[model samples]
Target: MEKEFVVIGLGRFGGSIVRELNKLDIDVMAIDSDEARVNEYADIATHAVIADSTDETVLKSLGIRNFDHVVVAIGDNIQASILTTLILKDLGVAKVTAKAQNDYHAKVLDKIGADTVIHPERDMGRRLAHKLSNSSIMDYLELADEHSIVEIIAGPKLEGMSLLDLDLRANYGLNIIAIKRNGHITVSPDPGEYIQRGDILIVIGHDNDLGRFESKLEDN
Candidate 1:
């Protein structure tokens, strides 16, 4: 079976997803109540339609239930976003990814059965803060249960250290899963592998452990 996606609200978030999916040669349907916005994506999306998604009958007509995934990215209109998500779930859409305007909105989306709730703005802010606070951290991603995956640069302190000598998993409850160097990546490097200058360590651990690891790195 061919998989398909439905993007409601042809705003920045939704529109971007549509275009990216198109670039991947994936089937995507773009929808917006605004005629102009819908027209803007007509040439880009596999299908573009101007329709109010708040109405169940309209969705039924569009055969929305059969789509593999649906993203409700109604901009600024929290009520519409919530309503559309509710309708999509009620219609048994397999996966519903909704953009939440804020924390309370995310909670409601979760309670109402949104498979994934994203705060793009808030998440970007947090990600930037992590990088800024610790120059060693190039990137960070938050995970459930207060865990995170981080891309950190090795400092002079670790230049000659091997994974075995460091014993990161035991000492800091962290795992250096991969090493990136000079645009090349080494996955699951040997325990005897020594760290060199400019090596980027892809590590995963609980947030507290990560924080401790960062502080320890900064001290060196």
Candidate 2:
């Protein structure tokens, strides 16, 4: 079956998701209480409706439960977003992702059973800091409280070895999840994939191990 997604609050975050999902060929239903906002995504989503999601009857009428994923991106109106998430959870929506306005809002969403809660602004800030602090880090993502995935530009030390020779998992306890060469990405690269000077390694491991790897790379 084709995946179906519901985007609540047709604001920037929700609207962006709707457009991107449509580009991926996924079915998207965009919902917003604001008629103008709903109309904006009408050409991008499979369906766009102006209806207050905080109203349980309205949510039910939208067949929200049929959606495989629902994203709550309501801004300003925390009560409505929280209420909508609660209703979606109670209705057994398979997955619910919510955008938090602040720490308190995030906590409330967590308590109400939001499967994933994101602070896009805060995350972007952290990512920018990570990039600025380390010249070698191309990108970074916090996967969990104690784990992260980072893409680091390969330096001089790794220019001559094949992935098999590096044996990151056995030697450094890190996983080379992907490699960015030139402008292309090689996902789950083969053991024989040779490393070049300009390659960027997308590695995932414990935070401590990643730190150790970065330190070692810098020294080399």
Candidate 3:
């Protein structure tokens, strides 16, 4: 079955979602107050409506509640985004995802019952900070405020240690979720598998503990 999506606010984020979903052959209802933006996505989406999403009557008229998911992507107007999400939920939309400007905004969205919240700018800034802080860290993702998943090259200290020998879970509470070696990936490798000097480890765990594990690699 094709998944149906209603993307409110045809700004950069909303526009990107509309294009990508349409590319994947999913049905999308694109909404925006700006005529130019609505025209831009008219052919790309299943339906394009130039209307104010915050107005409950206009949204109801467009049958937005029928969509499987509704994404509120109002960039400049947080109030409009919040109100749109609230109306969608009240109208019994299946799911609502909102883009938030900051931590406070995310909290407000959560309090208002947003099914999911995205802080793209904050996430990007954190990744940039991680790269600056540790030249060896290539990528990072926060699973929670305290925990994260990171991709880092095996440094000198961990050159030839096997998974069992490291006993990562007992020693540091970190899990080696996967290993990328020689352009290939090993998911959930056996305990006896040996970690090579240049192998890349995709690990997940608490931030402080992961930092400790990285420092241990430096010590070895």
Candidate 4:
């Protein structure tokens, strides 16, 4: 089935999604109150409209509920963002993704039926802090409720140790989602597979548990 996406703001974040969706040949409608921004994506998106997304009448006229996904990317204007998301949900949009300005906005959006709330800047700051503070941690993805996925390099302490030896699940409540070694990726590697120095361990677990595991690796 073909998916249709409607982006409600044409700022950097929303515009990028629109352009990428166009590249993938997906149907995307770009909506912005600013005529200039709408014109910018007119040639790129499947459809570009100058409409006030906060206005329920405008959205209904556009048949926004018909789209498979709706992105509420309104920048700065928290009121408009909340209103638009509420209207989208009320109109029965199957999926509503909203960009939040801060934690408060995220909470409100979540409470108002936004299927997903993205607080990109704050999330990126946390990710960068983890990477900078822990050289072994190459990447981090924030998940709900203080959980995350992290990619950490296997240190000397873990050299030649197999997954069973680590017992990460029992000890740290972590699951090794994958292991990357020597440019080869192993998914759900057997417990008996030996870990080599510099192997990247992709792990998913609670944030505190992950921190403890990383600290233990650093200690040894």
Candidate 5:
């Protein structure tokens, strides 16, 4: 069955989520207190309504509990965000994800039973910093404080070398989880698989190890 989602707050973050979900053909209902914002996604989302999610009566009338997932992306309104999340949990929503403005907000969301609390700004800053520090790194994602996954394009030195020859795990303590070549991805590539220049390698490892591996690629 297709999953249903109700996204409250039509800010940049929430708007992006709704658009992406729509691209995937998912059912999404977009809601916002601002009539202008709600109208913006009216033609895009499955349903768009101008409603304040913090009000219990408003949520109950919307039948929010029937949705598989609910996302509270209220911007600069921590009280509303917290209140909305608490009401969703109280109504027995299957999953609730909330955007946290800061550490304290995240803690409150956690205590109120938010399934996921995301710091989009902080996470995006980290990703941008990683990309800025390494020219070879195409993208970065933080899995944990010390662990990360990165996509790096193979350079001259990596061309024609098989995975067994490079021995990335033994040499740099990094693992190439997958390789993308000519738009096709090969997951868990065999040791004998030869790496070609321009191939994009998706590697996961400790931040320090990833840094060291990136340095090696730079030196080559």
Candidate 6:
């Protein structure tokens, strides 16, 4: 069965998600309080409507609860975002992902039964900071407050070193969950497999441990 998604708010973030979902051939309903914004996605989305999502009647009229997932991406309007998320959950929506403005907003959303709360700006800042901090780190994703998954390019130090010999888990308290080499990805690579220069290692561990590992790579 095809998954159905409803994106409330037609800002940059929400619009991008709708477009990507459309490209994947998923059914999407785009909503916004502004008529111009709704018109912009009229041809792109399965359905596009101009309605204030904070109003329960408006959401119910659209049958939003029937959708597989609903994204409350009301940019800058924290109150509206919170109310929309709460109403969706109250209506028995299967899943609700909300964008929060700050830590307090995120905490409130978490308490209100939002299935997922994302701070895109903050997350992106952290990712960029990590990339700037180390030349080898290609990307960084926060899994929790203290843990993250980082993609690091293998350098001269890592070349020809087998996973067993590196003993990443014992030595650095991190795990190489996958290795991307020449466009091929090996998930849970064999311990005997050797790492080649330019290989991308997907490692996950506590942030402190990841920092230590990056330092070791830099020294090599």
TM-score of each: 0.94, 0.85, 0.91, 0.94, 0.92, 0.97
lDDT of 1 by residue, 1-220 (tens): 8789999998888899999999999999999999999999999999999999999999999999999999998977999999999999999999999999899999999999999998888888879999998989999998877898999998888899998999999999999999999999999999999999889999999999999999988884
Residue lDDT tens for model 2, 155-204: 78889899999999998899999999989999999999999998999999
lDDT of 5 by residue, 1-220 (tens): 9889999999999999999999999999999999999999999999999998989999999999999999999987999999999999999999999999999999999999999999999899989988898788899998856899999988888899999999989998989999999999999999999999999999999999988888877783
Tell me the tens digit of each residue's lDDT in model 3 across 104-153: 88888888889999987888888888777775677989886789998888
Candidate 3 residue 167 Cα shift, in angstroms, is 2.6
Return the lDDT, model 2, position 98: 97
TM-score of 4: 0.94
Better of 3 and 6 by lDDT: 6
RMSD of each: 1.5, 2.7, 2.0, 1.5, 1.7, 1.0
Residue 118 local lDDT, model 4 = 99
Better of 3 and 4 by lDDT: 4
> Residue 103 error for model 2, in Å?
3.4
Give the local distance difference test score of model 4: 0.94
User: What is the alpha-carbon lDDT of model 2 when measured against the actual structure?
Assistant: 0.91
Candidate 6, 38-153: lDDT as tens digits: 99999999999999998999889999889999999999799999999999999999999999999999999999999999999999999999899899999999996799999999
In angstroms, how far off is 197's CA in candidate 5?
Answer: 0.7
Ten residues in a row with the worst lDDT in model 1? 211-220
In terms of lDDT, the poorest run of 10 residues in model 2 is 211-220
Against the reference, the lDDT scores of all candidates come to 0.94, 0.91, 0.88, 0.94, 0.94, 0.94
After the best TM-score superposition of candidate 6, give how far the Cα of residue 158 lies from its true spot, in angstroms.
Answer: 0.9
Off by over 4 Å in 3: 215-220
